[model samples]
Target: MTDDRPQGTFVLLDLDGTLVASAPGIVASLRHALHTLGRPAPAEATLDWVVGPPLRRSFETLLGEGGDVEAALALYRASYEAEGMFLSVPYPGIEDTLSALSEAGHRLFLCTAKPLPHARRIMAHLGLDAAFEGLYGATFDDRFDDKATLIAHILDERGLSARDGCMVGDREHDVLAARRNGMTALGVTWGYGGAAELAESGATRLCQSTGDLAGDVAALLRSETGTRAPVA
Candidate 1:
């Protein structure tokens, strides 16, 4: 089937929970870091939330105000770079979804809280390097920990207006980021964030599954006309 949709609709995709199941590696690295820092690790049940946010922030939360967040982060990176980074697995049907979107003429980019180097490694490991036109992420020093900053950077660097694009992610951060940047936000239920979180974050649409996602994105891209700032 020929896709008649217009090209250049930028689709910013979040990594970690949205693209791959990276909690196992992330949590494991956190645990290792905490252990090295002589701190107790949080229970495995509570670590799921750690996957989407900045690692230093997660360490700080677990270790309190006085925690050596830098040390913990360094230790975490040592282990993650060597082993944990490759432990992630893409969500089922993700590759097919990406391929479908690309074929439909949308320009895809990786917008994540993960550091650019690590994000690149993970993408390459999962064979997703070719799926995106560019990858934007936080610095190793945590300069751009928030999604809003990263999204804004992507928009500014790529010369894209919010109206010509949308952000797809599984968490409130993603929805809030897109909202902040005056772009459409599409929440995916298959990720760590539940439906309630996405709804409360004011997601423009909630995709129940990957199958639903491709159609919704294609429709949005086809229907979007020109640039306009998001409504307050």
Candidate 2:
């Protein structure tokens, strides 16, 4: 049986804030952990910042220098794993968008700061696991929590060139990671980072809505692969 799907660009996607609106679960877990530790949580206005970056760093910022970041992290994982993990939903039109991208022959992989096991489970729970060819993320030890390191590892392991990939995400970390690896970075304005942060971080393009995501992605990836035929 010959498969006829056109070889698509390597699309590395961020999980939280990009593919899914996971802030409710993430923020609730963080707040629960802080409360358990008897620490003060951030105000509502600023809590969204914790959704994209590593939890350890966010805890450090919320807990101050002498605070027990490890303990807070542990507490957060407990709460998140218990119930907070399922508190999110795919952004409106995201499922259709994913189908469109995959149908267009774009190879999709989830690239996230989230721990791998949790990410996998979340994907399964959300019925989104089938859309991705792979899920790349941090380990429990925080070794790959840095998006740049994770992305670099992904490129090397997958035998993919930075030139042949586009990082689709919502945060500065996502943009900066792609830049460090010399890949094109596309930012989605619907996520937590908004337009300003993505632009400031040097994203190659910004997608203003999920309605336009497939077209935007196709255009960017098309430009990147100009003159080179899609791989078989």
Candidate 3:
């Protein structure tokens, strides 16, 4: 159910690993916390790959049950809170895509699993906070644990129509969330998730690159029924 229309489109983007190059900051902070917890941080590549998902899940695997989840989160937030958050840079061309979507009259929303304050801070730090009409982040305050629930909350709060919203993200979590909510998922290959995982997770489309996505979505700008996003 792809809609190739310029107007009446609601675009939900995953912040970290999808629209933002958040690896360095997340990796650095995780590394600092792991060592403090007497656990070895995962390989750099593994950590980079972990950027898109929730922090608790990442800690669960890297730190183990013997590891204290709350403490690990607190420690991770220490470095992240002070300086590690800015270590990341946005991928080139993301601003362009956001600008294009805005100009096309698309309603842009950010959907991320990053905790509220951290996610808002990153968006503000990277100048992406101004890009979206609204942003939805996971929070201990809200106790939102899953993408599907978060997304539903976003739509409900923003008064967005489900048939008009599409998710652009880099992970299976994003894909599954969209499916559960009866929306479309567009996998981004330029980010963390692999193709098979995205496809298996029920991604309706997989863009090869950010550049490719802008072009693919251009047609969607004018469509109502939706168009299939190019996967290759």
Runs with alpha carbons beyond 4 Å of true place in candidate 1:
1-3, 222-232
- Per-candidate RMSD, Å: 2.4, 4.3, 4.4
Q: How many residue pairs clash in each candidate?
A: 0, 0, 14
Worst 10 residues of 2 by lDDT: 223-232
- Extract clashing residue pairs from model 1: none
Cα lDDT tens digits, model 1, 85-198, are 999999998999999888877899999999999999999989997979998899997877898988888898889978878899999989888888888888998888889999
- In order, the Cα lDDT scores of the candidates are 0.86, 0.88, 0.79
> Across residues 71-139, which tens digit of lDDT does each residue of candidate 2 receive?
988999999999999998999999999999888888889999999999999999999989999999999
Q: lDDT by residue for model 3 over 46-152, one digit each (tens)?
A: 66666877888888887776879888888989999898888878888888888877776788888898887888888888898897888788886546658888988
State residue 47's C-alpha deviation in candidate 2, in Å.
0.4
TM-score of each: 0.93, 0.92, 0.89
Off by over 4 Å in 2: 1-8, 224-232
